[model samples]
Target: MVVVGSGNSGAQIAQELSRTHTVTVAQGRPQPALPQRLLGRDIFDWLSALGLLEVKAASPLGRALQRRDPVIGTNLRHLSRTRQLRLAPRIVGTAGRALITQDGGRLETESVLWATGFRPNYRWLAVDVLTDQGQPMHDGGVTRVPGVFFVGLPWQRTRNSALLGGVGQDAERLIDHHLSSPGPRRTP
Candidate 1:
């Protein structure tokens, strides 16, 4: 079995699946914990107002930016300590085969999954308000392009948007507003 992420959720899944299947875990740069919202504020502020400070804020993973802590290490160890979860360096090339480092030698695996997580790909969008990387460049879902808004984007206005459960309401509001408003101008 191929597991795409190395986070808590992915780790748990791989462990369970490995009992009956050979599991390979794809790891990315270690992550900091999700932030706790300050009272009377939304995640946008927590992200924009504080910027680096927010990234440096503390959580279950310890202070956001600060390293040299055992929290992240312990978590990784707990998930990967098992023999079932083998640490493969990384897969190279696009040949549908994986090269994993094991016992000072390279081994091949059957399947692979990109557990790298979500990255915004908005290249098809007709607007320029999005960042170069396709993320909506906005504060609190308020875009530079008026009447064009973003919802369900990571940390869009609140921490809720980042979670699966929180995106529905934001999507509803954005869609409602977009449909209710007039269409774009046409050539006269």
Candidate 2:
């Protein structure tokens, strides 16, 4: 099997599958890899201790941090050295039964697993809270449409805004803003 987009999900999936099936990780670009632990402590502990996780997306430091998401937990380099799991170049195309690569190589796989990540598409919404680039037009999740708010946006308020547990922080702030608005605004 072949996995496309070697982010966290793809790497984890490929690692697990390598035990039962041959796996190829189609890496688009190399990302910095961080071990799950450091100095006998969880990597997150260091991040929290350094306050990196709460950095705002707009700050110079946060801007630099968001430029490339580091691959966490899994060591892709070690995995690539193993016969069952190998790293491949970006997938350029597919022809019949073969998956083509940017280097003009082709891989024949019985299955292709895509973990390409997510892109928020606001085009389907009838609301006018979208920018010309088709992204939600909001100031820290508070849309001009007033009553509407968005949580779980990447860097909505901070680096952790999109995380499952972290979203509550963003939600709490938006609710505070919503309640403070002069009056209810149901439309843009």
Candidate 3:
């Protein structure tokens, strides 16, 4: 199988599939990776203790940190070293049943898994809260359009806002305000 991405999702999917099948991972670009643990502590524990995960998205420091887009934890490097997973360059196209790589090599695979990231789709929305870029125009999920709130958006309130473990905080903040605001309730 071919996994056409090397981010956390692709790396994880490749690792899982490697246990049963030969897997090749294709990277779109260079990425920095950090181990899940550091100095006998979970990396997220360190981030939480240092308040790095809570940094405001609009802050200069947060902007700088987001630019790195590091993969928090993965075993792909070790797996590659052990020959459990095969690494390849970006996949540019396909020639029939084979994948054409950026380096002009052709790889034949049974299937392909595209782990590329996603763009938010808000065309179904009927409100005016969308920005020119179609992102929800809000301050940490509090929209300028009343009663219209967003949660789980990338960096919605902090670096962890989009993570499942961290989204509860953003949700709590939005819920508290939403419940307190005197307005008609509309299902979201």
Deviation of model 3 at 17, angstroms: 2.1
Which candidate wins on TM-score? 2
Please give, for residues 11-114, the per-residue lDDT of candidate 2 as tens digits: 88888999899898888897888999999999878887898879998899989988897888987888888659888999999999899999999999999999
- TM-score, candidate 1, is 0.56
Q: What TM-score goes with each of the models?
A: 0.56, 0.93, 0.90
lDDT of 3 by residue, 73-141 (tens): 876777888756888989998899999999999989889999988887997899998988887889899
**Rank ordering of all candidates by TM-score, starting from the highest:** 2, 3, 1
lDDT for each of the candidates?
Answer: 0.55, 0.86, 0.87
Instruction: State model 3's lDDT.
Output: 0.87
Clashing pairs in 3: none
Q: Per-residue lDDT for 99 in model 2?
A: 93
Worst 10 residues of 1 by lDDT: 65-74
The candidate, 1 or 3, that scores higher on lDDT is 3
